[model samples]
Target: MDNQKDKILVVDDETSIRRILETRLSMIGYEVVSASDGEEALNIFRKEYPSLIILDIMMPKLDGYGVCQELRKESDVPIIMLTALGDVSDRITGLELGADDYIIKPFSPKELEARIRSVLRRVDKISINSSIPSSGIINIGFLKVDTNKKQVYKNNERVRLTGMEFSLLELLVSKAGEAFSRASILQEVWGYTPERHVDTRVVDVHISRLRAKLEEDPGNPDLILTARGIGYLFQKIMTSN
Candidate 1:
């Protein structure tokens, strides 16, 4: 028996939902562990070290936002927020807290499963590709992006970035000065086509997060620039005498 099955931590306050997910995900070959509330979720996470987390937003003793924030402090594990709140602001809040993605309540099981697979695939791809040799380092201003190590540094000090964040940066940096539209970025980075009515503000949220970490003045970013009417682009590094 292979012990390498991807472990998933399902955190929801609803017992039925937990049972359903456990059964469904287990049938699909994942090892599913669950917690009924936010605090227990954290405890289980520490012990299980799951490959992914499907976290519900509303719960007692803490909340999904708290869990996501705590996890981001140490782990870059993929998080997909499940929530009853359908407001765009609520979704943005989850994304801002480092959640990799989100799904609203009454979601189709198939859609949720697909999302799970997509997030996991991204994680696997990043892990495998980071081990391969590539362009060593890209210097942009005071920042150093080490492609080989999948790490970044600012003024020789290490900068913490989630795997997804690094992937986004790599995409833009790979084609510096090339403007990538939000739709293209979604296709290239998230491996999905945006639905006509689906809010693609996720891309903007992530870009903001990246700028907060990478730019000296996030309000007026110098490295990652907005390509007015398009989307965004990485500014070519400028050399000063």
Candidate 2:
């Protein structure tokens, strides 16, 4: 029960919703912190340095988007904006503003829990990758992986990635054309043991994120390929396209 592992922040104007989220998240061993509006959220965010944020797009002051923008200026903490089911614009705005993910309103608590667990797992994987030893850059086609610096580049342009995202990319690129199973990815990327019931759908979410960051076209991905219900493959980008 590491205290640092449990840190989270919840921002929503609805008192009942906030209270419910606080209670539910706390019951699952998270250090829950809540704020009613964006202004207070910014203050608490700076003071606490939370690991993840559950933000509401609509608020009285500052709003979730503003809060997300302010936080993005300081850190790469994961954010999940809560938006209405039909509010398509806010979802785009949230992602464009550097939010990590988003959730529509009336979401099931279980889904939220799954997302939290996924984020925590991904963050943990990133921490481990940073400490591993890498002698030099590993390149496949136009993709360049620098283990020593823990950096990546495509055709000379630097590509930004979170810790887990980088590890996942490196693994696939390191073994280009070989498709891996969901469980195989969990064991290799996350270091999760066999007994753990870790949901492998997390792998899907991460691949999506990686595509958004690395692909010229996320819809028809050329780098990260999905094998229906199987897993993913990393295609070498031989000469820019």
Candidate 3:
């Protein structure tokens, strides 16, 4: 939440672009770190461990996708890429490489600021998810998830979960502990706010990931059971083991 401590790494090849971005971000109270190329960007990233990254797709020495692939293998930090090409394919590729969001070249300063804030907020929530204590953990005899603390325990053992997956589990288990529609789940868990629908496949992926880690058998899920045409449910724990 501290703008000073929450650093932003702007990686771009063009000097003018970097200068403009740096000035804009700094004016708005953000601490800006700039890199000329992908290689330099990686160095700064490793040294600074910035909370959020604003990467440009085209760069010298190393391209955006290559750098992103390397970074994602190590950390799950939020990344919002800048695509000079402004092509839908480029955006899709960036997303495929674990980017949180993307903006075309010549984007608005206000829009950039908004995206950065959104990403940082989510990252902050994720950091707290594994630490804070929720009101309660949805225990379903076999599995348990503490929504407040964002911790998952299965068979009395703590289980690791990704951020989005944890959000999905919390949404399902905290509510009626019953099935809900996929569209609803996407809206609630993934923060899909726009009128245009999001990729429902994303939910399917997260659910599969949660079941694999929490359930003794991921194929046949008991904690997150599917109801035909309805959605999925997190059966409430009647008795704790």
Candidate 4:
């Protein structure tokens, strides 16, 4: 495709699913490439360097989880897994493997499009935030966040965060001590509507991921705090350095 929009790599063993997504996503302005198997998907991914990937869990040669693990070793590109398994454990496995999102099979085209736009929007928002001069720094003790560089450093050592994890951290730290409800967080962070009835556990999952990356003690985080009945909050607010 010869389009200016961010490219999407869609990986599925099912030809029909790939064709449907390719047609629908292209209709909404995303430049899309479809792969019939995981091996081909990885080949195209390396060559095309797509902005995002829509990977299916079951495929020939290699599975989506393996593909995700492989890709994460080299890049932090956004990933959204496609799965027929609706079990919570399967979804958790995908998230733990660094996927940004997941959609079950038989998903609505509109919902899928919304998810694609949402992921891209988060990436673009980070870019925009990074461009602002005075709003770039957040230093709390030994933890330093540079929104301009899209980086985090703890005790002077660089910390690696996936795209979704970084977005969640940025949202909380940008407004320190402010408690955000799970529903509000879902809407703001993941671009989910209340009407969509999205699982709020997605928010919980990301929070756990962020804690693992940024906290000195993931079990008892001092920075990102639980608000009990409300939601979650960034407890400290040191002046931007």
lDDT of each: 0.85, 0.74, 0.72, 0.84
Encode model 4's per-residue lDDT on 84-162: one tens digit a residue: 9867788778888888988888889788888988887886674454423486878888798888778999999998887
Write candidate 1's Cα lDDT for 1-241 as tens digits: 2323799999999999999999999988899999999999999999999999999999999999999999999899989999999678988899999998888898888889888887777655543344223555767789888776789899899998876788888888877888999989877777777885454777898899999998999999999999999999999773322
- For this target, which candidate reaches the highest lDDT against the unseen true structure? 1
* TM value for model 2: 0.66
Clash list (residue pairs), candidate 4: none
Return the candidate ranking by lDDT, descending: 1, 4, 2, 3
- Least lDDT summed over 10 consecutive residues: which range in candidate 1? 126-135
Q: Kindly provide the TM-score of model 4 when superposed on the true structure, using C-alpha atoms.
A: 0.91
lDDT of the structure predicted as candidate 1: 0.85
Where is the poorest 10-residue window by lDDT in model 3? 126-135
- Clash pairs, candidate 3, are 132-149, 134-148, 134-149
Of the two candidates 1 and 2, the one with more favorable lDDT, higher being better, is: 1
User: Which is the winner by TM-score between candidate 2 and candidate 4?
Assistant: 4
- For model 2, the superposed segments whose C-alpha errors exceed 4 Å read 2-4, 126-137, 140-150, 153-159, 163-168, 171-175, 178-233, 237-241
lDDT of 2 by residue, 1-241 (tens): 5533678899999999899999988987899999999999999988998888999998988988898888867777878788884745546677666665566788888878776777666655432333233454666565677755658788889887765667677678666778888788866765553333334545667787788877778999877999767788877543221
